[model samples]
Target: MNDELRERIEHEAEKHALLNAVKHDSEADVGAVVGPLMGENPDFREYGDEVPGVVAPVVERVNELDTEGREKRLEVVAPDQLTELESEDETDDRALPDLPNVDEDTDVRMRLAPNPNGPWHIGHARMPAVVGRYKERYDGWMLCRFDDTDPETKRPDLEAYDAILDAIDYLGFEPDEAVRASDRMETYYEHARALIDHGGAYTCSCPAAEFSDLKNNGEACPHRDKDAETTREEFEAMVDGEYAAGEMVLRVRTDIEHKNPALRDWVAFRMIDTPHPREEAGEYRCWPLLDFQSGIDDHLFGITHVIRGIDLQDSAKRQGFLYDYFDWEYPEVLHWGHVQIDAYDVKMSTSTIKALIETGDLDGWDDPRAPTIASLRRRGIRGGAITDAMANLGTSTSNVDLAMSSIYAANRDRIDDATDRAFLVRDGVEKAVINGPETGEPPVHPNHEERGVREIPVEGGVLVEPDDVPPNGQRAWLKGYGSVRHTRDAFEFTGDGIEVVREEDVPVIHWVPADSNHPLRLRTPDGDVEGHAEPGIASYDPDEMVQFERIGFARIDRQEDDRTVAYFAHP
Candidate 1:
């Protein structure tokens, strides 16, 4: 082959090798690599009679390059094109049910209203995924509404506002528009005034305890009889801070003898002395409650549907009263029961989790023990896996109590094919002296040979996990090497190659050159485990997932020189 032809072949071969490495494969088939290049550049296949000879040298050169280096080059060459390699045939079984009454002119809109009191946990994550699926199905809009009006009780945090957005984006759901309840205080006030003018709401000056007692006895507060003109003046006074924090509140008028006492004269707007973290501190004292604020925003934002937890049915009922007073149609409401994973001991309350984080009882939100989306992302769980799990749950209203095994199983299925395999020996290392070739190269991935190989300089000593070292005289197979017998302080070589010499279910243990392994500290749900990983691990970027030969999959959290920190994802 001419030098120019040789150079062209070698360059295309390098690109193909990089593509395989980027997918975490050991290698690509010669045809898989060559066909794409030929399709992209017809000149590469111009050599009619000498095609095999030209391709043979190019393949050899490609295989000789390091897998890690190829991955870096691939990132530079085609950053946007590199995606997870999942088989197309691996279809999701749970498809979204068809949305009702959606058509070309239908402006389908939904909102994920999260209280910005704390970071989003796993339970809170499903809402966005569920609504996002519908949004996709209808080609509609999603509004990320921050229900931050309960500043005194729930206490909105400035950082949590952005954190919620980040979590939603991490789940692969981007809102079409974002709104904050604190920003729309004037709009709520207008609605409150309108409600008062219609005699549907009244200002209650009775002490909270007294009102609770009267409401429990099916009696209205003394102020409930005041005319609209009087209530409007009291509401104006409330806006002007004439009353102390709990001395007065605007309550929506409802059936005094309603079966649910909570629905009787529910508080619509109240005074909070605590200043909001994000908004101008103490600029406005009167704040709208969730029911009033959501009820107003739903109409203003043109929301066509509302999907929330079944526990919030009372809130919907309370909001419906406001809708009736204004003669406004309420959006279609759907409630799903709570999902509980039995494996978690932590209550899925954002407030409780925030308190735990503050007291240092747990690590920050991304701690493996916490079920926040940040923690899952840090632990290397893919967004697709989370969406798939949510889809599988469907639109069931019945409460679900399941084990973590199903989630891990779903995650494993999505990630297994793309995760590169490496040797990681935990709980300290043991030396295995093998009597074999001085050097070896194992394919980086077992299924794909074109991905490349990892160099192993085997001058004798190989590092193996202490547990993998069998009892004296017992046989064990050194992965990528050969079968060996355990002797005192050393592994005596008993076989010639990787082929099995004895067939009594000998354990296949991964090993690395004793001096070449890097220190790896893995944080798991149970606790931390220390180990040594093959040096190739250093090449992985933070958040990249990799499988430990016999151990489970782990995502690299960070790397500092020779030490690497990883979070155990799943088995």
Candidate 2:
């Protein structure tokens, strides 16, 4: 254990001891101090049967002090630390700001519409939490809409649909209803006809290059001037397969001379021959563009709030025209700026990551290197931590690049109080024969006596990491055991009891009985690290998060009869 962690454990134990001492009007009981200390610093509970030995001295020291001295010691511990502990018991009811124009009578509805082309990454995962917070705050309904219309470009994969749903479910946001755009083709066609009938949209037969040149020159295509009836005929002909793909396109009647070229005469629908994976193959050819479909769906689905990334601001602008054409009220749209993680070597793009997965450059969507929600979850990052991190970012419009350290710190704060610790020797392992009692049992958690103990049969040598073994005669501490002197061949136990060495520079390391260890394969973000883990590790369930003594935390992935696989989470 590092000195920092040890100090924290001691500090927490002292606080508990002081509280117990004052409550009983006598010296603090070892059990009273150990229980609350373990509750506060769960990592200490890893000491198992040795928890009593580790905390007994602290309890004895507190007992040696008089009531006045105990009061003085309590004062010495910072007041803020005590306040922090007290605040922890209070519930976190913090919520997002209320939506605009919403009241008891106003129906507040939101939707998380995602293209089912790939698995949801960390970037995609933020929406559900943001929307879910709003949903709870306003008691609104949330819809999970799959925008799987463009099969030619952002092609829909059958597996991706379920994967997206699974990702949303993992985030703990259960949508009130689920809808698919592919299933509502006729609705989009109806809207297209209405637009043509109202002269709000037109069918253009101009060749792609010619229309692009005309639009660039601030001129309209000949087809753009065609009458509503003529445009309707062309649209029907195109939809009936009379026209080959790209021979005609349905363009919403935006200004041809608009400052933004893309905003000028945007394509509402286009012909694509690529077959959709889910819907009947080639049953539909004319696909509605994302903006067109989303606009129609949002209004039709009674969505009152549209929360999405600022990149979709153009989509909202295009949708505004359609809303105006239909004489419908546009939903309140809120766009948040991009969230960038500074630790990522490359900006996380779904399409780029998908290509990497296809090329076998990555293991899968859940590969630790990827920022997918699955990857984070696989690395033992809790969903609550993810939500907390996002909430901390708060709805800021400015693009922010956050450090991975900040994210991991938030996660560590959450899991630290619950996760237990264990011992593992990485790289080359050296055997240390301690000159101590024949057998020992230490509490699995220094603070949690109820977790029971692990038997350490001293007849077998204890396994220690090679780097932790100091030079000859240098004092070192075997955690859960006492102080020892490192020799060339073995660690000579130099203490008679489990007393913590006050020497600040002495290194402390975790150890496992050589005979009671099994081979461990730890999958880290960098690569697989081979090590020897205590036999007790086999009892942990898959996905259980545990801190490796003197190492970082890891998630148990699986355990076969002989070999165990784990994923390194963070330090």
True-structure lDDT of candidate 1: 0.76
Instruction: Return the number of clashes found in candidate 2.
Output: 16
lDDT string, candidate 2, 1-571, tens digits? 5667667777777887776665445666454455445644668867634454445557767877998787778768755554443454311134355577887898789999988888887877678878877777678899999999988788887888788888777776789999888999989999999999888999888889999999998899888888999889888876776767888899999889988887889899888877777745458888898899999999999999998787878888788889899999999988789888754553488888888888997888888778788888898988766766666665667786655554565576566556777878876466557667655565676546798777666567777767667788786677766677877778787874433443244555677777878888988777788988877788899999887764567899999888789988775
Query: How many clashing residue pairs appear in each of the predictions shown?
Result: 7, 16
Q: Whole-model Cα lDDT per candidate?
A: 0.76, 0.76
User: What is the lDDT for 130 in model 1?
Assistant: 84
Q: After TM-score superposition, what is the CA distance of residue 561 in candidate 2 from its true location, in Å? A: 3.4
Top-TM-score candidate index: 2
Q: With candidate 1 superimposed using the best TM-score fit, by how many Å does residue 142's alpha carbon deviate from the native?
A: 0.9
Q: What C-alpha root-mean-square deviation, in Å, does candidate 2 show against the real structure?
A: 6.6
Candidate 1 lDDT tens digits, 1-571: 5888767766766576467545545544333344445545667656532443344334444455577665566666655555433322222334456566667898899999999888888888778888888888778899999998887888888888899998888778899999888899889999999999888999988999999999999997889899999899999998887777998899999999999999999999888777777756457888888899999999989999889888888988999999999999888888888888655567777878888999997899988888777777888887767776776676678997644554565676577667777778776565757576665566777666688877776674778766567788887777666778888878887864433422254656678778777889999877789888878889999978887765568999899976999998865
Models 1 onward score TM values of 0.81, 0.83
List runs of model 2 lying over 4 Å from the truth: 1-95, 344-347, 405-410, 496-500
